[model samples]
Target: MGADTVYVGYVGAGAITFGAPNVLWNHSERIEAILRTRLAVPVIVDPNEARFKEIMEQKGNGDYADSYKETKWFSSPQEAAMGLDNETKDKIDFWILAAPPHFRGTTIEGRDLELEMIKLFGNKANYFVEKPIATTRSDEPHKVAPQLAENKAVVGIGYMMRYLKVVQKVMSIIKENNLRVMMVTGRYACAYKECHKTPWWMKSQQGGPIIEQATHFCDLMRYIGGDVDMDSVQATTLEHTEPAGEIGVINVDEQAIPPEDRIPRATAAFWKFDSGALGSLTHIVGLHGIRYSNEISVYADGYQFRINDVYTTPVLHVRTPADDSKEQVFSYPEDDMFHNEFYAFLSSAIKKAGKPPLPTEDLLSTEFLSDFADASKTFELTWRIRDISDAHADKLLAQKAASSKKASA
Candidate 1:
C-alpha cells in the first residue's frame, strides 16, 4: 500500500495454491515466480490455517514451507478486510481471488463473492481472478464489467494460454496475414474421474466439465474465431451411469438432480461467431493425463493453424494456402505461460503507477490477452450450453411424467 512497494491480497488461499487436490490446479509456483520479479511486495493471504499448515507439513521442513509461512496469513477474507485500515487497503496493489469454483456458495454466488472482494479494494488495485469467469448462467457479468474500466485498474481473467509464445506467434501470423477466419474447432479432453475428488463431482459445485475445465478451449475458440452470437449457439450433453451402457438407460437416486444437474461425462456445443465463422467444441472427460489431446484448430481463407496441447506443451502448426500445401511448426519446449501471465500483470500495474520502468512486451502482451469483458462473452457461451441442455432434459421429464399419469388413469 505504499509508493515503493506493492501489497497483494489473496482470497481463498488453498484452492489457488499447492493445497488443491489436483496438482494441475495448483498455482503457487506461478505466484512465487511473480513475487521474485517484483521488489518489496508482500502478500496477505486468507484461508483456513489448518489447510495452510497441512500444505507446509506435506512439503516437509523445506524452503517452500518456510516461504509459505512468511506471508501474512489470516483465517478468511472478511477477517483480513476488517483488520486492514483504509490506508493499508489503499496500499494494496493487487488482489488474487483463487477460491474453488464450486465451493463457498456454488459457482454463481461464489464468483459474485470473488468480485465483491475486489470491489472492497475500491477498484484502485489491479486484480486477477481464476477462470470460468462466472459460475452460473444467470449471473449479470455485464453489470459489474464496467467497474473495471471505471476503476482504471488492470483486471484480468486467468486465461494464461493466450500468453503462450506459440499462441502469440500464431496470432502474429494471423494478424500479419490479415486472414479471414472461416471456422474454428477445439477439443478439450481430460480424465475428470481422476482429477475430480469430492465436491468437484457435483455439477452445482463445479458447473460440470465443460464450464470448469474445457472452458480454456472455449475461450481459445472465441479468441481465434471472434465473438459469438448468443442466440445462434446450440448445445447437447450426455451423461451415463455407465458410459458404455445402453443409450436409453436412465437411472438416478430418488430426489437427486433430475438428470439436468448431473455432471455430464461428455458435451458438444456449436455456435456461430459474429464473423460468420462456425465454431464447434467437444469436451470429453475420458482418457488419463497427457494421453488426451487438447487442441484448437482454425481454418482461415489462406491458412490452417492449430495449437496442440496449449496447457502442457504448446506446439503450433501452420499450413499455408489453406490446403496443407506447405507445413510449418513452432514449438515452445520451455514455455512458462503462467509466469508470463503474471509478469504481464505486474508490468501493467507498474506502468499504471509510473513508478518503475519495465519491458514493452509485458504491457503489449497483457493488452492482447482477454480482460473481464472479453472473457465474459466466452463464459456466457459456455453457460448457455448448460442452460440449453438442462431445458431440453427438463422438457423430456415433464412429458414422461404426463405419459405415466395418463397410463395409470
Candidate 2:
C-alpha cells in the first residue's frame, strides 16, 4: 500500500462496532468491496487479548474474514502506537470510537486513550465517534468537542436516524409546503433485545433508556420540529422491577429479567419548543422481539405527518385538508440507513488532498445529522427531564407521607 493509503483504526471492538447487525456486521463485507475495488486502506482494531482471540475465532473462519486478514490487531491503542514506527504512524488516517456509552468519560482510560490518539494523529486523521458521545455522569463531550473543533478536524457523530431517507423526505415536505410547526410527538417503545442485551437497561450504567436509546427521537424533535425550550420541559419516570425497584441488580448474563423493570419501564414527558410548539415523548422498554415500534410525528399549521417503524420498516404518512382528509403513505422499507451513514462518513474521510473541498468540521455537512455540539443540547435536555422527573416523584412521596401523618393523628 502507498503512504497516502488511509489506515483506519477502531478504538473499541464491542457490540456497536463488531457485534451482529451493528456497524461492522452490516457493512464489513461492503468495506471489503470498497477496499478491494475502490480504496486500499488497512484496518487496525484494538481489543484486549480475550476479545482479540474471540474476534479472530468468530470472524476468522468466514470467507470475508480473509479480506481482514491483513488487518492488524492490538491489545490497546498505546501498544499499536509503540509497535508502529513513525513512518507507519503517518499512514494512519482515521479513527472510529465505538466504546460503550458508559465507558466514555473524561477520566475513563479507554476514552482517554482514544483522545490521546486524536491528539497524536491531529489533522492527519479524521474521526467518527458514536453517541451518546458521553454518559450523563461524565460530561466528557464538553471536554472532547472543543479539542476536535479547535483542530479543524473532520468528524461525525452517530446520530444516523437523521440520515434516514424517510426522515429527510418528511422534513423536505415541511419546508416545501411552507408549514408552520405546531407540535411534535415521538414514541420509542422497544424491547430488551433491541437494547443490545446488557448494561444498556441499567440507568446507572447507560444513563437510562432516555439518554442512551430514546435520544434519537429527542434529537429529531429538534431537527424536524424545532428547538426545545429547556425551561418548559415536564417529565416523570416509572420502574417495575420487584425487590430491586429503581436499582439494577440483574447481572449481564441474566436472560430472564423483566424488560420494564430492568431499565425505566416508561418515561412520559412534554416540552415546549422555542417556537411555542409542544413536544412530547413516551419511551417504554417493555416489548418483545427484535423489531421494536419507533415512530415520530410532526403537526404543523396545515399538516399532520408521521414516520413509523423508523428503525426497521420506515414509513411516512401525511394528512391534510387538501387531500380530502385521507392519509398519503410513503415507505422506504429497503433502505439500509446504517450503510448509507457509514458511506457518507467514508466519502469525506477518504478524500484526496487538494482534490476538492471536504467537511473540515466535527459535524458533517449532511442534512439533519448532529455533531457533538448539537447532540450536547439533547443530552442536556435528557438530564433536565431526569431531574424534574425525580423531583416530582419525591414530591408525591412527601405528600403521601403528610397524608399518613394526618390519618394517624
TM-score of 1: 0.80
TM-score of each: 0.80, 0.81
Q: Per-residue lDDT of 158-260 in model 1, one digit per residue for the tens? A: 8977788887787788889887889999888775434535445467777777777777888878887889988998876665543541233123331355444
Error of 1 at 172 (Å): 0.6
> Which candidate number has the best TM-score?
2
Model 2 Cα lDDT, one tens digit per residue, 185-232: 999986665445566655566667787777788888888866788999
Q: What is the lDDT of residue 235 in candidate 2?
A: 91
Question: Candidate 1: global Cα-lDDT?
Answer: 0.67
Local accuracy by lDDT, each model:
0.67, 0.67
Model 2 CA deviation exceeding 4 Å by range: 1-6, 21-27, 33-36, 39-43, 53-69, 105-110, 192-201, 239-263, 286-291, 352-368
